[model samples]
Target: MILTREAITTAVEHGDIVIEPFAPERVSPNAYDWHLGDRIRVCEGDELDAAAATRVSEHVIPAEGMVLRPGRLYLGVTHERTHSERYAQMINGDRSLGALGIWVHVSAPLGHVGHAIRWTLEIRAAQPVKVYPLMPFGKIVFLSTAGATASYQHLGHKYTRTSGIDISRLYEELR
Candidate 1:
């Protein structure tokens, strides 16, 4: 079952869900709004290979804002670091940002129960759009899990404890 806002609050209160730098205002009815971090890595190659791609240029979004052009992928990070001991976390694009044609997290949106990291956003724009650091661009919802589950750390996942925008680690698996 998906957790409600009250349940989320209760979980936080009971030390079940952890969101760093938590803000009361950022909590919605069922999810917590997350802000964009200052750093972004824009892919600079024409073709990308999941097992070989590594060419990217990092840019720090200025306070004024940075424009995201169409047909380009920008890997961004969330300002908040999150962890869930009991529930699986799912990150979704904020409706306000989506209305502006900004797509966050292209495919990988589900996180494991013990996933602890600052979310990496697979951002793309339908058109030209400007985004600022610390802007609320994503929302994370926690889902209840049943039975025994393994943590990403326990699994030795390459992207388990990332603190910033992490380039695809699929290449590591290929090794």
Candidate 2:
């Protein structure tokens, strides 16, 4: 019971969902594209060998640098949390830092887990971001399609798409 564009549009009209500083060009038929922010926190430490990268402890090696270098991972935010929901957390680098590597952590499916969120992300160096990570990404409208259909047969039901695939295809379509 994923939401349709029209339902989402109407929900946005009523203020049930919110998004700010939207760019006019990125919305697609279903979801809006988000931008990267410039305030990145790098996880610096002993040059990690293959096994030391993943499973980073709760500790963080604070960085003062701005640019995300290759092979280095970063601590960042999630697309799902709001200012009210997210709590500060951190993750370590993956030795395989490059194209197709993780840019963040996903503890549960997206949307469902954000209500009371806590998890960290590991960002990679791929492009120049125009905003700050503290800023929210994507837009939200009411999305009537999530709980019901147009036929009026099934109404007020909740639905969610897999967060994994929603983003995996983003780069494919962008390319």
Candidate 3:
């Protein structure tokens, strides 16, 4: 089942969950809001190869903000690094951002029980929209697993310890 705000607090208190730079005010009734990081990476080529698409251009959002255009994928990172040793995590686009036609994640929003990393957002815009760094753009919800699960660390996941926008590692994993 999905965890409640109190449950989340308890999990953090018990060391089952961790949110670096955790802010009490960012926690909602069921999820916690996450802000956008300063850097963004956009793929440089028109054709993308799942296994070897390292051609990307990185940009930093300025004080005035950056414009996100449609038909392009922008990889963004969350300002907070989150991890849960006992619970699975899911990141979703904040409602306000969704209403503004901003999708913070695509299909890779789910995280394993032992996942410990800052989220790399699959950002896209439905239209031209200005976004600022440190903007609350995503919400993360924790879920309880039925039984004990293996840790992502021990599982050798490619995206386990990512610090910023991770380019696709599919090719390396497939080799």
Candidate 4:
């Protein structure tokens, strides 16, 4: 079941959920609004190979903002570091940003249990859109799980415990 704002607050109080620099005002009815981190990475090559480690160039979003162009994949990070061993997480771009043609993620949105870190945002703009550091970017909703669950950390995932924007690690699985 999806957690409500009250449940989220209670979970945080009880240590079932954790959000660094938590703000009560940022909590919505069922999701928490998260901000954009200062750093972002853009793919360096025109041709990307799935079996090879993707090359990316990291850039710090300036104080004014950075413009994201169409037809380019930019990896961004959330400002908040969050974790929840007892619940699963999913992120989505807010409608306000969506209307401006900003997609916070391309495909991956599900967060595994025990995968504690700042989320890497797979960003793509339908048009040229300017984004600022620490700007309200997206919302993350938590869900309760039933039955037994395995920790993502124990699974040896390549994207575990990330601090910044992480490029595709699918190459590791292909090896």
Candidate 3 regions exceeding 4 Å error are none
Q: Estimate the TM-score of every prediction.
A: 0.96, 0.41, 0.96, 0.97
Model 4, 10-120: lDDT tens digits are 999999999997999999999999999999999877888999987898999999999999999899999999898889999888998999999888599999888798999
What RMSD does model 2 have? 12.4
**For model 1, how does the per-residue alpha-carbon lDDT over 1-175 read when each residue is reduced to its tens digit?**
8899899999998989999989978888999989999989999888888888578999999999999999998999999989987899999898798899999996999999899999988999999999999988889999999898888778987888788888898887887
Worst 10 residues of 3 by lDDT: 45-54
Residue runs of model 2 more than 4 Å from their true location after superposition? 47-67, 77-109, 113-121, 125-175
Per-residue CA lDDT of model 2 for 54-116, tens digit only, reads: 323232223332344557555554344221111111222223332334344433223331222
lDDT of each residue in 63-145, candidate 3, tens digit only: 79999999998999999999988999999997799899998787898989899988898989999999999988888999999
Order by lDDT, highest first: 4, 1, 3, 2
Off by over 4 Å in 4: none
Residue 149 local lDDT, model 4:
95
lDDT of 4 at 93: 87
